[model samples]
Target chain A: MNDQLIALFITFILVAIIVVIGFMSGRDKKVRSSVEEWSVGGRNFGGLLVWFLVGADLYTAYTFLGLTSSAYTSGSLIFFAIPYSILAYFISYFFLPKLWAVAKEYRFTTLADYARGRFDSKLLSALIAIVGVLMLIPYICLQLSGLQDTLQVAGKGYINVQVIVIVSFLLVGLYTFFSGIKGPTYTAIIKDILVWAIMLFMIVSLPMIHFNGWNPMISHITKEAPQLLTIPSSGPKAFPWFITSAIVSALALFMWAHAATGVFTAKSANAIRKNAMFLPLYNIILTLVIFLGFIAYMVLPKGTNPRFALLELIHMSYGGVAQGLAYATIALASLIPCSIMAVGASNLFANNIYRDLINPSVNGARLTMITRCMVFVVIGLALLFGIFFPTALVSLQLLGVAGMVQIFPAIVFSLFWKKQTREATIAGLVVGVIVTFSMYFAGKSFGINEGFWGLVSNIVILLLLNPFFSKRAGTNAIKQFLFQK
Target chain B: MRKVLLIILIALPIISQLIALPFVNSIHPIIVGLPFFHFWLVLWIFLTPLCTWGIYALQKAEGSID
Candidate 1:
C-alpha cells in the first residue's frame, strides 16, 4: 500500500482503460479473417497514424531507458544514436518508398515477399523472414527486461518482478491479439502525445528549474565525465568497424519484418517519407531522455540499476500525478513496441514459417490466429528471461541488431542489382551473418559494441563474395524485374 | 528447409560467445549525463549515420568505379 505502488496502480488503470477502449473500438472481429485485415489494419492507416506508429516502433522503451543509462555512464558516447537513427531514416526514405510502391502494387505483406518479387526467390524471402523473426524475439526480450527493471525501480520492493511483467504485458498482448495493428497504433497515438508533452515539459522545465540552463549542465557533465562529452580520445569512433556498423544499422533499420509490416499499414509511401522528415523532432524527447539520465546520475546511487534512471528521475523530481504519469509512459514505451515486435515476429512465423512450411494450405484467418498465438508465446519466453538473466538484455538487443543487419545486402542490394541471383543473396546472407557475428564477439572481447566489427566483416565478405556467386542472371528473370519496373 | 536453416542461423549469437574474438581493447570511458552504459546510444545516433553513410558512399564509389 505504499504511495509509489498505489501510484503505479493508478497509472496501470489509466493505461488499461485506454487500452480496453482502443481494443474494443478498433477490433473488427468479422474482418480478422484475412491477412490484409489482420496483419495490417486493412492496409488503411493515414500519414499521421502511420507516422506515430513507425516512429514509436523504431524508438522503444530501451531507447529512453538504455540510452539515458549510456549518457549517465559514458557521457558523449550516447550521441552515436543520433547518427545511426538519422542514417536509418534518410536511407529508408530513398529506398523504402520504392519498396512500398512495389509492396502496395503486389499486396505484399512481408519483406520476404519483396525479396521474392525482386530476386524471384521465395527461399531468400523466407530466409530473411526467419532472421527477422528470430532476431526480433530477442529484441522483444530486451523490452520486457527493461519493463521489469522499470517496475522494480518504481514499486521498490512492494511488487514482485515476474508478476508485474506478466500482468503488465498480458494486457498489451491481449489488446494486440484482439485489436491487431489498431491496438498498438491507437496506443501509440496516446504514447506519442505523452512523449511530446513530457519530453518538452521536462526538456524546458527541468533545465529552467534545476541547473538554470543546458550550458551549466553541459559544463557539469564535462567536469564529471569529460570522456563522455566527446568522442573517444583515440579519435572520432575510430577503426573502419565503427563506420561499417553505423551503415549497417541504417540499412538494417527497415529490413526488419516489423518495418515492412509497419509500412504496409501506411496508406502511401508519402506518409513514410513525410514521417522520416520530422521524426527527428522525436529526437527532441531524446534530449530529455538523455537529461533524465544525467539527472539520475547526479542524484541516484551508482550501484542502483542504470536502466531505472527515468523512473528514478520522475520519483525524485515530481512526487504525485507526474510520477504516476512518468512511470506509465516508460512502461508504455516498452509496452507499445513489445506488442508491435511480437505481432511482427508472429506474423513472420504464421506467414513465412507455418504457411510456407508447416501447412501450405493454411487460410488467412488461420494464419492470423497463429500469428496472435505466437505473440503471447514470444512474450511468455521474454517474461521468463526477464525474471532470470537480466544483464543479457543489452547483449540480446545488440545481437538482434547485428543479426537483422545481415539481411541488408540481400534486401537493399536487390533493388538495383537485377542480376543478384538467389544463390548470391543466400551466400551473401550467410557470409554476412557469420562475419558480422564473428566480429561482434571479437569487438566485444573488450567492452565496446561488437556490431561495428561484425557489420564490417559481414559487408566486406558480402560485397566481395556476391559478384562471384552470380556472374550472370537468367535473361528471363532480368526481363521480368527490369520490364516489370 | 529455409526456415529450418534460419533456426540454425539464429544460433550464431550463442555460439559466438563460446569463441574469442580479436582486436579487443577497453577505453574505460568515464561516466556522463545518463550513465556509462546509455550515453553511447546518443553518440551512436549521430555517429552511426555518418559512418554508415560513409560506407554507403564507399559502396557507391565501388559501384561507380566498377
Candidate 2:
C-alpha cells in the first residue's frame, strides 16, 4: 500500500479504538437516567478525571493547529495563548471552586442555571444560555475545521476528506449522545496521553530532523525570517492586541458553558483548586508545541497555508504510521472537545430553554432525551455552518470568544458584587455584546482585542446603572444568593 | 499571605504587558532556545500554579475552604 492508504488504515484503527472507548466509558458509570447525570457526569468526577476532562475541553485541536499556524504565519503574537491560559487558570483559581460550591448546592447544571438563581430572573438565565449556545456553535465548527485539516493532510488524495470529516463527527456525535460527559472524559485520557507523547516527540525530533540542532535552526530562522521572532512584524497583531487579547481571552476561557460543565464535575472545591495548580503543567507542553510551527517555517516553502503547516510538516518528516498517529491525535483533539461542547450546549438548550421557558412540567428522563437529541442538533448545526461558511471560521471563532466574554459581568461579577441587579446586568450584557460585534464588524480594535473593548462597556454600564437599579429592586434577592454561602 | 499571592497571580500576566518589561521581551537572552518574551511567559505558566498551590495550602490551613 501507498503511504496514504497505510495512514488511512492506521487512522481507521485509531478512530475505531476511540469510538469503542467513548461508548464503553458510559457502561460502568451510574445509569444516566436524568439530564444531570448525562450533562455533568453526576458531578462526582475526581481530580484526575476532572483534570483530563477540563484539560481536553480547554485545549482543542484549534490550540494544536491554530497556534502553530499563527506562529508560522505571524510572529510572537501566538504567545498570547500562553499568558492567556496562565491568567485563566489563575482567575479560575479564585472563582471556580466557589462556583462549584454554589453549583452543587443549588443543583446548577449550566452557567445559565447559576445566572437564573443568582439574579432570580429566568430571562437572564435564558439569555446567558442562548449566548452560550450561539458562541459554542462556531467553536464547535472551528473544531471541525481542525479535524478537516488533519484529514486533508493525512488522507491526501486517496480518501474523500469531506465524507470522512462528516462521518467522523457523526460518530463522535453518536457517542456523545449515548455517553455524554463520561464519553469525553474517558476519551480525554487517551487523547491527552497521545497529545503529550506526540508533542514531546515532535519537540525533540522536529528540530533535529529539519536542522542540525536547535541553535542552528534558531540562527537560520533569525537570519532568514527575523521578523518571525518579533511582534508587530508588519501585521495587524500589535502589542496592544497581544496584551488586551490575552486578558479578554483569559476571562472568556472559563466562561464557556463546557468549561463550566468541566468545573462542575469536580467532586470537591479542592479538586478544582488543585486542578488549577496543575493545569499549567499541560500548558508547558503547549509552549513546546509552538516549536513545531517554528520548525515548519524553515522546512515548508513560502506561501504554504499556515493552517496546514504543522500537519504537512509531519507528513514531510515522518513515515506513514507516525503521520497516522499525529493525524489521529489532532482528530481526537477535535472529537474530545466537540463531545464536551455538544453536551454543554445541549444541556443549556434542554434545561434553560425547554424546561425553564417551554415546559416546566417536563420530567427528568424526557429532559435527558431532549438534551441527547439536542447534541445531534448542535453538532449538526456546527457541521452545516462549517461546510457552508468556511471562510468566516476564524472570525466567527474570535467573535465567539468576544461574545462569550461579555457574560463575565453577569456571571463572574455577580459572585462577589451582590448589588448587581438583573436590569443592570442585562443592560450590560446587551451593550457589551453590541459593542463587541460593532467593533469587530467595523474593524476597530484600536490594537486591542475587540472583546476587551466590549468588556469595558459592560463593566461601565454595570457599575453606573447597577446601584440605581439594585436599590429599587432591593438587594433582598442578591442578599439571599450571597447568604446561600 | 494568600491574598497577596492571589493578587500576584492575577497581576503577573498583565504586568509584563502593562510595563513592557524591556529585559523580558528582548531576543538576546534566549533561554532553552526560546526568546526572552516566550521564556518569560512559560516561566510564569509554571510558576502561577505554584502560587496557586500556595494559596490553596494557605486556604486549606485556615479552614476557610468550602
Candidate 3:
C-alpha cells in the first residue's frame, strides 16, 4: 500500500479504539442519574483521574498546534505557554482547594452554579453561563480545526477533510452525550499517552533526522536565522506583550468552564491540591514539545502556514506509518477535549439556564436528559461555526479567552472577598468584555494583551462599586466559607 | 511561614517570566543547545513544581490540605 493508505489504516484503527473506549468507559458504573453525575463523574474522582481529565480538558489539539506554530513563526515568545500554565497551577493550588470545598458543599456542577450560590444571584450566574457557553463554541470550533488540519495531513487526496471532521466530532458528540464526563476521563488517559509517545518521538527523532543532533540543529538555526531564537523588543510580540499575555492567560486558564468542571469532579479538596502540585510536571514536557516547532522551522521550506508546519515536517521526514501515528495523535487530541468541552457547555446550559430560569421545577433526572440533549446542540453549533466561518477561529478563540477572563471577578474573587455584590460583578463582566473586544478591533496592543486591559477594567469597576454597596448577608457567606473546614 | 511559602510558590513563576526574561534576553552562552533565556525558563519550569510541592507539604503539616 501507498503512504496515504498506510496512514489511513493506522488512523482508522486508532480512531476505532478511541471510539470504543469512549462507549465502554461508563458501562460498569451505575446509571448516570442526574446532571451532577453526568457532568462531573459524580464528584468522586481521585487525584490521578482528575489530573488526566483536566490535562485533557485544558491542553487541546490547539495546545500542540498553537504552541509549535508559535515556535515556528515567533521565537522565544513561545515561552508564554509554559509560564502561564505553571502560574495557573500555582494560583489554582491556592484557590481551587477552597473552590472545590465550597462547590462540594453547595452541590455545584459548573462555575455558574458556584457563582449563583456564592453571590446569591441566579441572574449573575445565568449571565456567567451564557458567556461560558458562547466562549466554548469557538473553543470547540478550534478543536475541530485541529482535527481538520490533522485529517488534511493524514488523508491527503483520498478523503474529503470536511466529511471526516463532521463524522469524527459526531462520534465524539455521541459518546459524550451517552456517557458524559466519564467518557472523556477514560479516553483522556489514552489520548495523553498517545500524545506523549508521539510528541517525544518527534521531538527526539526529527532533529536527528534533519541536523544529526539537537544542539547542532539549534546552532545552525542560530547562525542562519538568529531572529527566530531571540525574543523581540518592539512590535506586536515584545517583552511587555509576553508578560501581560502570560499573566492574563494564566488568570483566565482555569476560569474556563471545562477546567472548573474538572476541579468539581475531584473526590476532595486535597485531591485537587495534590493534582495542582504535580501539574507543572506536565508543563515540563510541554516546554520541550515546542522544540518541534523550532525544528520544523529549521527544516521545512519558508512560508508554510505555521499551523501546518509540524505535520508537514512529519510527513516529509517519515512518509508512511509514522505520519499516520502523528496524525492519529492530533485527531485524538482534538476529540478528547471536544468531549470534555461538550460536557462542560451542556452542564452550564442544563443546570444554570434551563433548570434555573426556564423550568424551575425540573428534577435531577430530567435535567440530566436535558444536558445530554444539549450536548448535541452544543456540538451542532460548534460544527456550524467550524464550517461556515473557518477563518474566524483564531480571533474567536482569543476573544473567548478574554471573555472568559471577565468571569474571574464573579467566580474566583467572590470566593474570597465578601463585599462583591452581584450588580458590581455584572457591571465588571459587561464592561470588561466590551473593553477586550474594542481593544482587539481598534488595534491597540499598547505593549500588552487586550485581556489584561479587560481584567484591569473588570477590577476597576468592582473596586469603584465596592464602597457604595452596604454590608449584606454575603459577608457572612465568606465567614461561613472559611470556617466550614 | 505558610503565607511566605505560598507567596513564594505563586510569585516564583510570574517573577521568572516578567523579570528574568527581559534581564536575560539574549542568544549567547547557549547552555546544552538552548539559549540563555530558554535555559532560564526551562530551569525554572522544573523548579516551580518543587516550590509547589513545598507548599503542599506545608499545607499538610498545618492540617490544612484543603
Candidate 4:
C-alpha cells in the first residue's frame, strides 16, 4: 500500500480503539442516573485523573496544530500560550479550590448552577448557560477544524475528510451522550500519554533528522528569518497585544464550560490544588510543540498552507506507521476534548436554561437525559459552523475566549467579593459581550486584545453599578456561600 | 509575611512572561542554541511550575490544602 493509505489505516485503527474506550468508560449504568454523575463523573476523580482530564480538555488539537500553525505564520505571537497557561494555573490555584468546594456543597453540575445558587437569579444562570454554549460552539469548531486539517494531510486527497470529521464528531457525541465526562476523562489518559511521547520524540529527533542538529536549525532561522524569533514591538500582534492576550486568555481559560467541568470533577479541593501544582509540566510539551512550527518553517517549502505546516512536515519526514500514529494522536486530541466540551455545554443548557427556566419540576433522570441529548445538538452545531465558516482556528478560538471571559465578573468576583449583585453582573455581562464582539467586528482595538477592552468595560460597569444594587439585595446567602465548608 | 510571599510567587511567572518581555525579546546571546527570546520563555516553562510548587507547599503549610 501507499504511504497515505497505510497512514490512514493506522489512524482509523487508533480512532476505533479510543471510541471503544470511550463507550466502555460509561459501562457503569449508575453514571447515567443523574445529571451530576454524567456531567462530572459523580465528582469522584482523584488528582491524577483530574490532571489528565483537565490536560486533555484544555489542550485540544487546537493547541497541538493551531499553535504550531500560528508559530509558522505569525512567529513568536504563539508563545502567549505558555505564559497564559502558567498564569491560568496560578489563578486556578486560588479560585478553583473554592469553586470546587461550593460546587460540592450545592451539587453544582455547571458554572451556571453556581451562579443561580449563589446570586439567587435564575435569569443570570440562564444567561451564563447561554453565553457558555454559544462561546463553546466556536471552540468545538476549532477542534473539528483541527481534526479536519489532520485528516486532510493524512488522506492526501484520497479520502473524504468532511465525512470523516462528521462521523468522528458523531462518535464523540454518542460516547458523550452515553458516558459523559467519564468518557473523556478515561480516554484522556491515553491521549495525553501519546501526545507527550510523540511530541517530545518529534521535537528532539526532527531537528536532528532535518537540519543535522538544534543549533543548525537555529542558525538557519537566524540567517534566513530572524523575525520569526521575536515578537514585533508594533502592529496588531505587537508587544502590548502579546501581553494583553496572555493575561486575558489566562483569565478566560477556566471560564470555558469544559474547563469548569474538568474542575468540578475533582474529588477534593486538595486534588484540584495538587493538579494545579503539577499541570504546568504539560506546558513543557506544549513549548516543544511550538518549536515544531519553527522546524516546519525551516524545512517545508515556501507558500505551504500554514494550517497544515506541522502535519505536512510529519508526513514528509516520517514513514507510514509513524505518520499514522502521529495523525491518530492529533485526532484523539480533538475527539477527547470535543466529548468533554459537548458534556459541559449540554450540562449548562439542560440544568440552567431548560430546567431552571422551562421546567423546574424536571426529575434527575430526565434532566440527565436532556443533558445527554443536548450533547448531539452542541456537537452538531459546532460541526456545521466549522464546515461553513472555517476561519483561522486560533483567532476564532481567541474570539470565543474573549466572549467567555466576560463571565469572569459574574463567576469569579462573586466568589470573594461579598457586595456583588446579580443586577450588576447581568448588566455587565451584557455590555461586556456586546463590547467584545463589537470591538472584534469593528476591526480596530488600538493594539490591545479585544478581550481586554471587553473586560475593562465589564469591570467598570460591575464596580459602578454594584454598590447601588447591593443595598437592595440580601447578603445572608453571600455570607453562607463564603463560609461554606 | 506569608501572604506577601505567596503574592510574589504568583507574580513571578507573570512578571517573567509579560513585564520582562521587552528586555528578553532578543535573538542574540543564544543559550543552548535558542534565541534569548525563546530561551527565556522555555526556561520559565520549567521554572513557572516550580513557582506553583512553592505556592502549593506554602498553602499546604498554612493549612489551606488539607
Assess candidate 3 and give its TM-score to the true structure.
0.96
Encode model 1's per-residue lDDT on A1-485: one tens digit a residue.
66676667867776676667657745567536666776777777888888788877877878888888887776655655654565567567567766676677777788776676677666776788788877887778878877777777677767787786888788888877777777788788888888778777776666655677765765576577556544454543433334444555666788777777788888876676665554544564665676667766776777876766667777777766777777777777888888878778778777777776568797766777787787788788777776686677787676788788777777667766765667756876777677667756665423334554555555566666667766665655433644474
lDDT for A391 (candidate 4)? 72
Q: Could you tell me which 10 consecutive residues in candidate 1 chain A have the lowest summed lDDT? A: A235-244
Best by TM-score: 4
TM, every model = 0.82, 0.96, 0.96, 0.97
Candidate 4, residue A258: the lDDT equals: 94
Better of 2 and 4 by lDDT: 4
Instruction: Summarize candidate 2's per-residue lDDT along A149-190 as a digit string, tens digits.
Output: 888877777789999889989999998888888999988999
Interface RMSD of 2: 2.1
**CA lDDT of A99 in candidate 1?**
69
Better of 2 and 3 by TM-score: 3
lDDT tens digits by residue: candidate 4, A169-240 = 998899888887888888999999999889888988899999898888889889998888888987767889
Compared with the real two-chain complex, what DockQ does model 2 have? 0.62
* Candidate 3 chain A, poorest ten consecutive residues by summed lDDT: A470-479
Candidate 2: which stretches are off by over 4 Å? A233-236, A474-481, B1-23
TM-score of chain B of each: 0.42, 0.68, 0.78, 0.91
Where model 3 places Cα greater than 4 Å from the true spot, the runs are A28-31, A472-479, A483-485, B1-10
Instruction: Flag clash pairs in model 4.
Output: none
